[model samples]
Target: MGVHTTNGIQGVSVSDDARNASARRGKKGLLIGSGVGVVALAAAAYVGACYHYKDAIPEGTTVAGKSIGGMTSEQATRQVLTLKHPNASTKANVTAGDQSFDLAPASAWKPDAEKTLDGVTEFSLSPGRLLDQINGGGEKIEPVYSVDKTALTTLVKKAAESKIDGAPKQGRVKFIGGKVSIVDGAPGHGVDEKKVADAIASGWPKKTDYTTELVEKNSDASDNAVQAFAEGDAKKAMSAPLEVSANGQSVTLTPAQVSDVISSTTGSDGKPAIKVDTEALLTTVLSRGDKMRVPAVDAKVVWKDGQPSVVEGRSGKEIDESKVAKIVGDALVGDHKATLAMKEQKPAVMAKDVNVEALPSTSMAHFESPFPTGPSQQARIHNITTAINRLNGIVVQPGEQFSLLRALGYEFTKESGYVEAGTLQGGLHLDGMGGGVSQVSTTMYNTAFFAGVQLDEHTAHAVYISRYPMGREATIWNPGIDNKWTNDTGKPILIKAHVESNKVVMDFYGTKKYDVATRTSGKYNIQSPKHRTVKNVKGCENTVGGGVPGFDVDVYRELKSGSTTVRTEKIHTKYKPDDIITCQN
Candidate 1:
């Protein structure tokens, strides 16, 4: 009980029960306030820990068994480059079997930093993670590395292929000495390049090299299988030359000649089956060198009595593709001779062709190469004539691209009518198949340069040939190297090739679009030829300077309309130095 004062302060009185209730309330309030303070302290600790470790891998995180936690991605990448050692990558020489692993590094193995970071523990306040961070973090991330697997596989495969001493061959048809021979193979030990590549990839960016060994190889094709195939297919289809008759004329196709168009695969019945490339076979028979029937000749512009004249094109016969396959297949089982059905084909340029005399009457650009004086150069002239014939009177539409290889159908082999001739290879003028065709290519390149057409692609010869222009010439090889151009003019372009007694001429005739002015820079970076010893190549009589010094030059082409410059392009040629070869044995 409390006594109340009317005017001033009153003295409070407490009973035993009231005093107990007040004490209880005071104790409860103090306990609740203390609990709130503890919770505030815990929240501050969690925030501080999370903030301290943001943008960083958790502590005690390791890569390749080395600690890398608390480090940024850049810092972690640097550590991975070292791969736990300073000189580890310096001595990374690898070998397989007896062959050395000598290949241009496609690319070095790099640490997959992003992938590694994916495994890292990010900032988190979970109980387990918080406990882990308190006890110096325990997330272990495996080292991830990336490399070009294809390049590694190719390198290893090349090295392993050299271990072919006493190696078993896959059984297949072999054309030896113009005869079809069935080769046999057996199951044996061989180096597996893919397996070795995988093994190396697993431990890439490491220091050690592997001395790989041969593994048991499965038999690709059994000897019995190939022999059975030979009796079933090769014996009837490839044993003798195929006689293809059309237009009352017959031509012989040797086994070696036809081998390129034939393919072999396992049949559905588990027997070896042979497939004839019908389209390719048709093409082989239609090319000028091997055509059994006359093809339609397009109307062309020609010089007659020192004046332009239009030669009327005539209809010619083409082998009927619809019936040729069945006829050829049926003949293959018998005497290997079949008479192809022929049909009339119209010329691309019709009789009412465009008159050259009425349109552009003169050649816009022209180039020629003089014939060399030698009997060995006959093959070169023949190849030049063949290529020229294929490119003559060709019309390139506006915005069309022309590939010289495609026009000539570049196979450059005997079956394609190109024989062995002198061509530059490895700084030596050895007799190479389809050699003299480069002369035609050089002639065309010069003509196209002056024609002001866009040069899509062109490659210079490794060795300089004195006959062609010093820096404005081009050479082509199988598949990869080629001469290509685009007709920039908004008009049709005509290409004409003429073979003279003393020289080969190439002319480009069209609406005179632009006056292309060319200026060539002087040769720079001149290098003298090196003296070399020749062993494998034969028939070199010179012991002195067999080749000319190599140098680099740039040819500039400026297209103009009267006085204003339209566009400019530069063709840079770098010729390699040749060797003064001395054949000793």
Candidate 2:
């Protein structure tokens, strides 16, 4: 492994073989040294190149067209364009670099502060991908000869200009008639479309943030100065209280008290006179960000069924009805005018003792029938009254759900001795607590239909009943079938029901502006015969009925203006009679 060559004259004038070996050794050493020297030169050259470009254009200087101080024009320009650029644009904004630059013209040394470079403009590029390409020897100084900043800015501005502002803002507020309302917040005056196009070209207001804030008129400096110039007394609008009446008692407000109520209301312009919705104001005031609170006046509670009503200090009392009607009429004085909304409300907590005994005292007492006697008969009568009482004073908000079980807790049952009555497959039959309840449900359904509420889920009885108005009856099975509906009339609905003697009647009271009536027509579609066999049990008889064809019945309710049918709905009930079979003992 060792081949040693002595320096200079180590082996002079040797044998021919020794001379050849010496020449070979000298050649090998020369080749090794030449290769080593070449490698050293390459390392030194790499280090120098890195040093020359290290701070080429300085760290902060935008490199798109800036010059590097340490190198010649060609070298600096190459270095400037060699580094990678970052991506500032997003997918939704389109992938592009966000940082913009102004490049001096090829002949100019510095950029003009006020003018765009005639021949050059900066563009966005992906930082990660572009950097890889730059290191891999991609194009240096990408050309801007064909790029159009004006056109590109215009395109992006259209996509970015007040995108959220244009959309309606949603907020919850207390509305008139003692209800919580969700409505669109005031929309921003639309963007100056022409100005937007202009701003994009000029780059005005480079950064923007959009948000919502509760604006207080008195607290805002801008509002204070504007209020100073207003003509009417500011105190008058801010402090006025509205007048109200309930159950024969009337409350009148002094001018000073009225002003106090006014100040509590919200609106950039100032507080409004007349009726104000306190529920709406409370919700708005409690919301985060910007909000204000105003002291509310006293309110009265109007109750039904002798139930002690709940009076909310939170929600302001309703205004005088006569004044309300007059104001409404005045608002509609012209061909078309905004409605003067009312803030009317019934008692939230109805009077207690709303049982059957309490039914004889209220205004609904006039509709009660004589009480029943027999156990089964009395159960039926109690069922009807109990069902109706659940409806009494129950306020169904506009678009709210009305659940039958929710209305009737657990006061009914069959095991509790409300006998299993009715025919096996022909007449009205009872099973448990829900038995004989259909009559009451049907009555409610008819009343709702006539009142024009939205029926959610309704099912027809297995067999029709004579007491009900044809196919207008709603049948239900507890824990299985239930009748559901909603008040979609843009107003709340109040339900009241009572039973006296042999007659059970249900009534629905609501704001009336339309005349509605219902009638049932058409026969049940009797399809194939359905048979049913009843098992014999204690106090029960086994009976079998032959199958009968199914039938379709229609209940029609026509909303009217005098005699004209304004809106008509068809209540379709499909009846499938049970199968008939011979019974054997």
lDDT at 463, model 2: 56
Give the per-residue lDDT digits (tens) of candidate 1, residues 238-295.
7778887887777678777667666555443445555567777766665433445555
Name the runs in model 1 displaced over 4 angstroms.
Answer: 1-359, 538-546
Clashes of each: 0, 50
Residue-wise C-alpha lDDT for candidate 2, range 379-425, written one tens digit per residue: 55666665665555565543355767445532244432344443232
